[model samples]
Target: MPDEHDQDEEPELELTSALVPFFVITNGRALPSDQQYERTALVTALKGTSAAARTLSPEAQAIVDLVAHGFLSVAEVAGHTHLPLGIVRILLAQLEESGLVLVRKPVPRAEPTDRELLGDVLAGLKSKFGA
Candidate 1:
């Protein structure tokens, strides 16, 4: 039987090995030239659907699998993959270039005017504390 120390060390080793590919993909690489993929942009995999994904590098394949369930923001992808934001952006740009992933820009939310916000706040206060 494996000793307790051996069992504990196995998972750590596995994790380090898993991160190796990401390091290889990103190391010594410049940020992708395209600046369109904002951190909040949503990314979805076209994996089986996009013929290009068949030739993806291991790092890109890992990202495709993560997005297989649903779309995720670029920042979320970086966080989940344990890659730096710049590296994730570079990977995403490459995948997008090959049509393996769809990057949707985040919708810009309109800020409410101060007058409109104050009106709503006043209504809420009146409802709770009486006019």
Candidate 2:
């Protein structure tokens, strides 16, 4: 038989956080006005822009806060906030429009076959190997 105390006790209630959908967070917007914020693009908060951030949603504000101190790549921001890349791009565009942040595209990669550079490398290798 169960104890009298056990029978009188109520089951404990478990609390859980509500799940918010991506559309809700992004206000049903699919893409940003421009495609400037690629995954590797660097972003930083504009100085003295905290006042403007007050009007942003929680997710947008989080992005501004993350970049306030320094620069962070779009991919880094997504990873840090656990937000999807597409969502991050949208939020960043909004922040940039509000003058809350600055975005810098990554430097373009060098051409794979710079004739002069490759020739120099070949000459160095031939001299080193006596070929």
Candidate 3:
């Protein structure tokens, strides 16, 4: 029943909501100027449900947080942490094996898993100086 144009629209419907990105409630104006606000709010929501993450060893938690964000490469972790590339990659592999971490795709796409969102926020705030 759908045309080719309709089929192309289907994928976007999966991830985007109809709600406008932002609004000035008092002024009754749509203020959806920044995509980053959506990203920030979603990250906050994900973190709300992740109390269990605190139970992880500090280093492991750090690793999880780092990889979950848009910083999706092992080399980024190494550069940020100032750890040797081999050590960082080895730890990442171990985390993956232990079900504590994963390697996300190279490009950050439209949607992210809950864990990814939480990890992104935490990664963005590893330290006051960095954030």
Specify the highest-lDDT model's number: 2
In candidate 2 the C-alpha lDDT for residue 19 amounts to: 75
Q: How well does candidate 1 score on lDDT at residue 109? A: 75
**TM-score ranking, best first:** 2, 1, 3
Best by TM-score: 2
lDDT of 3 at 112: 50
The lDDT per prediction is 0.79, 0.86, 0.48
Worst lDDT run of 10 residues, candidate 1, spans 10-19
Writing each residue's lDDT as its tens digit, candidate 3 over 31-126 gives 332332222122111223246566654544666676555434555566665655544555554455556554543434577569988887888787
What residue pairs clash in candidate 3, if any at all?
none
Instruction: Judging by lDDT, tell me the better candidate of 1 and 3.
Output: 1
The residue pairs that clash in candidate 2, if any, are: none
lDDT of 2 by residue, 1-131 (tens): 54555554685444565478877888887686445788889999999987877888999989999999999999999999999899899888778878899999899888688899989999999999989
Off by over 4 Å in 1: 1-23, 27-29, 33-35, 47-51, 111-131
Question: All candidates' TM-scores?
Answer: 0.59, 0.69, 0.36
Per-residue lDDT of model 1, residues 1-131, tens digit only: 45566765446444535535645786555687545778899999875754656666767788988898799999999899888888888888877877778899899779767997899999999999997
Task: Tell me the spans in candidate 2 whose CA falls farther than 4 Å from its real position.
Answer: 1-18, 33-35, 114-131
